[model samples]
Target: MDKHNYKSYRIEAENICVDYHGKVALYDANLRLKAGQICGLVGMNGAGKTTFFNALTGFVNISKGKIRINGESLRIAQKYQAIAYVPQSEGIDSQFPVSVWDVVMMGRYGSMNILRSPRESDIQAVKDAIDRVDLMELSSTPIGNLSGGQRKRTFLARAIAQRASILLLDEPFAGVDIRTEKLISELFIQFKNEGKTILLSTHDMIHVREFCDLVLLINKTVVAYGETSEVFTPENITSTFGGMSPDVLLGPES
Candidate 1:
């Protein structure tokens, strides 16, 4: 764990490359995001959006280059649980024997002892997170019984309870309703106000434009990245997704 300081950039990746066996998933990838920012990670399917997130979390082997979170090396940052990740809803099994409270409490495991016991502070954190997500009424509900939006909020509560400086969210808006979308959008702004850096991948360009001031566009590699106003254009979208307009992806199934 190198104690290197990366200034104000809460998340930074330099010349990263990911190889799945002999197949290269990502190459020549680079990104830097400052604290108090929301960045939309947009790319085509199988274009390495998840691969980039995995590289940052050290869930995948980085074939080359480095990533830093909170100005420290990714390995060290990850060791301290510096980043909180909320993966796509499809990855989680709702049939598991877990309550909303049970899932939120998992966030505190990183701070607990070998027995994984929860302290008063941990309990309070979980409660506060659940409250923030307005899920106190359903806190005791089994995950399998929750609706799509409630399930999404439960996982978001988990991330909130983790209290990490950086958050990586994959398609948070995928299965949510209009009210849930509004809640999430508000939460993003609140997180930014708290100086928490967030990077979320979404196929919907409308949400990206409405929620993020910055955007990172990816194809096989990062084609363009910067302020959304400048980088998110017809030409860049055309380059990244190959002739698909931003409107075509706004459908519910896209």
Candidate 2:
């Protein structure tokens, strides 16, 4: 796609602050994500990673500052067409009796004509997304029947099917098996190769170091933001994680 045709900056968050109830979650966080890059947001628990994701996707109303996608500020409803967000939840209620394919099909609702039902092409896109995530065989199964990793893959398929330019994933690998994690990492690389910008928040420093092109360290604020190696240094990691040794968290550099 031509540079002018596609968005220049996949997503930009400028001086954004978010509050839940009376407490502040993210404070003046600024971020710039480019097309075709996979970036990681790392921080300890309660450090505002998810809150930042919510703010960027407009899921949570911002207390201050602005967020833009493709140079345009996005409203909550409008954001669904441009970005795909996968929260940390394992899966929706298993007893709800939703099929995996149906769940994936929901991703296309953002762009679908509300007056009309989904057509054959939409079904094909859902199938393609399931295949991309290697869930073709299980596409007919109940989402509740799948394992934690499989559930993650299902949501990833949904995001892929959305055909959004930007993806925001919150702890996607949490509770997932090692094999699923590897598969998800490979899928992320494929998305990057296709020029889709990806931003993910996780505590998995090892995967972040290995896969992310850029790293943003957050602790209710922007602590360090730059290349993965540079920001993952002992001092920076220690400071961000509250005096925890980087070696222990990063697992003895290469």
Candidate 3:
């Protein structure tokens, strides 16, 4: 990939810093995500992954730096319509009387006017998203009733429906079964093929190695960021994760 392709810079962060209350979550964190690529943000628990996501999505105010999309300065409105954030927890309330289809349609609320209801095209988009995630059978079912893996798929479908060029997914594969993980990996590939930029925070190093074109190792600050194979070295992994090697941590499954 051309390192300085301005057109490919879907998302760019310059010295981003965030503090929650009195605690610093991220300090001088910088990253750039190009189009048609899947970049993995890997770090241990409490490594400021979600904090960085919140900062990028404008859900949390940053103390320093600027985040831009397509070379334009980022705004909350830009974040709403141009960026899709899939958090670790499925935000859908299982007990709520909302169907999976309805949940997916909610993603379009950012673009919908107050006076207008969902158009046929909007409905079609929702259907297409559900189909993409293989959640068509459960489209009419309650989201709360689905298993953990199914819940992840549902949120991914919601992101797809949003039609965002930049997708930020946090721990999307956590609690998911092997099959579901594979399916999500394939979905990432599909997104890449469509020229979408995906930034996912995950603990699955093996998956990162296999699927991600780039990897950013972050722990409050960016330790390393580059091609997966080059950045995920034994020395780099050990430094990032306190001496735990991939073979010991991920094992043969990796």
As for TM-score, the candidate ahead, 2 or 3, is 2
User: Model 2, residue 90: what's the lDDT?
Assistant: 40
- Give the Å error, residue 253, model 2: 5.0
Candidate 2, residues 1-254: lDDT per residue as tens digits?
66564357778788999999989998989888889988999999999988888787777999899888887778743655788988776435755588889889988887789753788889889999999888999988998788888888888999999998899999888999888888998988888999999999888777787789999998999999998877777788889999988878877653
TM-score of 2: 0.92
TM-score of each: 0.94, 0.92, 0.91
Q: After superposition, how far is residue 16 of candidate 2 from its true place, in Å?
A: 0.2
Better of 1 and 2 by lDDT: 1
Model 1 Cα shift for residue 116 (angstroms): 0.8
Writing each residue's lDDT as its tens digit, candidate 3 over 195-239 gives 999999888777788789999998889989999978887677777
Candidate 2 regions off by >4 Å? Answer: 1-7, 76-80, 252-254
lDDT of 1 by residue, 98-186 (tens): 99999999988888899988999999999999999999999999999998888899989999999998999999999898888888999
**Residue 3's lDDT in candidate 1:** 46
lDDT of 2 at 200: 91
Best model number under TM-score: 1
